[model samples]
Target: MRFLSPDFNFWIWLQHLDTPDNNLNIPFEFTEANMRQVKEILSHYPSNYKQSAVIALLDLAQQQHGGWLPVAAMNKIAQILGVPNIRVYEVATFYSMFNRQKVGKYHFLVCGTTPCMLRGARDIEQALLEHLKVKRNEVTKDALFSVGEMECMGCCVNAPMIAVADYTKGAEGFTYNYYEDLTPKRVVEIVEMLRRGETPPVGPQDSSRIRSGPSGGNTTLLSDPKPPPFRDLASC
Candidate 1:
């Protein structure tokens, strides 16, 4: 269930320095258009509380920087928000959603909490890693895919689920889609679809089911219920 260990901070720091795809040495600033968006985001908060937009700005920065936030990008966000650099770093590190290092163009986050685990989440993870020929958090040689583990994504009814973040189309075309109720074979087929630049349908993989409804069709509420009883308050 735990994706990060106690030494995660140290590991992430090392990655910042050593990861070739993430050039931490380079400077990062918001684009002119992104800056305009930043201004719009800041507008939602009072001028005195611009710092409250830290998380939102960090997300924008990540999107602009190709799906991960480098040290430079975090620093730039701190500067823009007028807060200490550590504040931005804290937010980024605390949230699993923020990737400190580089990820593949298609990053798969498999839910591994109790519900998902009991439903074959581990198998899904293994299938993805094996088929992609990459370990958890490691990008494939083609830079098209990577796999990671996540806690419950609130789709327990669907159980075994994955959330895919597609960065192939850049920030403007970025998409985060969820695929739920999967078997090992089905999940791998979804990956192959991505490899072929095809978008597999999102949500439950089982054709017989819809959304999180019962797999064998509704067992209850098959017919409309009688109208609610009404009291004559005026007469009383």
Candidate 2:
């Protein structure tokens, strides 16, 4: 549920650092203005307790740099928040939703949680490892896909979910995005497309077989229309 931490003063320092201006250690996409905006978002909370903004700030950095967080970016976030760099790393590492290493342009994290497992997530994981021709915790040759198994994604009703596309490009092509409600074939197709640098639609896949409710049918009941009656207010 959580994503990033926030910082203010340190971010400014990071911007003014001797190193050439950069974004996520990639090229510069997030400008100083962007960091200021992130700071504004963090300012809503006390500066000492600014870690609350970690999730949001991570998201902000990811968005700024095309979707992944580099060590530099994390350090900047740490400095801005006035917290130790390790604190930011701890948060980034603690959440399954955050990415420490490089990932594919469309990172696919298969959920192996109980609810997801009950719905056949193992096949999903195998499918990714096999389809992408990459092992768990390894990046593909194209640098466009890293498939790993993850914990619950909090969508039990959907079951068998995947977290995809947390990032766009870094050491890995993309990192930190999550996708849910999928089948092995569906995930494979999406990854293949991403390998070609294409975007795939997200959310509950367009499959009639998925069904709805117990019977896989609509539940709205129909009723007959009644005749309208006109009421006339006469003398009191």
Candidate 3:
């Protein structure tokens, strides 16, 4: 979201004041089944508060559009929710979770927060960029992969983790694999496996690391202790 030029940044901020653009001529629709789902979502709220379901409805639209929210999708959501098109646009732009632009089949959201960074998140990021031959937020030429940094994935114990979202597979079979406790070399191998259409073992990349436990073996509480015999209250 950072711009090098101050003037361009100001201009970009001005776009927020303008109405959401629906210039794209593409048609967007909610199918009968999805419409039923939308209705069910709306039913949870009162008639006056139906607009509360805007977020969920937009999510459905994004899923239907294959993981990216196109301008046309926002238009459809605005119409369905009986709100101004700019309202939906505001929510979409405010949220980092929503992908306004296109993403590759596998969107790698690598955690680069404090824990991950301290444990070598930069190495993992560099490896991914080199392997994909593209910079952050840029998709590969084949549109198979894209990489981006996230604040945290709540996997601090398994620092340097990434969530691989598979959009190539349809929503029904969509899968997100979290590859954790990564190294630069291991990440490269994982991406190569993905490129070959092979599933890589998820979770900790190290064979010795168990979940978030210490590498190799458990050091603390290494021995099992016998339970103390119960004392009878009558004896006291």
Best by TM-score: 1
Q: Candidate 3, after superposition: displacement of residue 68 in Å?
A: 0.7
TM-scores, all models, native as reference: 0.82, 0.64, 0.78
Worst 10 residues of 2 by lDDT: 1-10
Which portions of model 1 show Cα errors greater than 4 Å?
1-10, 13-24, 210-236
TM-score of 1: 0.82
Assess the local accuracy of residue 33 in candidate 1 as a C-alpha lDDT between 0 and 100: 97
For 78-184, candidate 3 gives per-residue lDDT tens digits of: 88888999999898888666767666888888887888888888889889989889867767899899887667888888888998988876556678789998999
Strongest candidate by lDDT: 1
Model 2 per-residue lDDT tens digits across residues 52-147 = 888778767766665456678788788778888888878876775665555565667778778778777878888888987876755678766776
Clashing pairs in 1: none
**Each prediction's whole-model lDDT (CA):** 0.84, 0.66, 0.78
Runs off by more than 4 Å, candidate 3: 1-23, 216-236
Could you report the Cα RMSD, in angstroms, for every candidate shown?
5.8, 11.4, 5.9
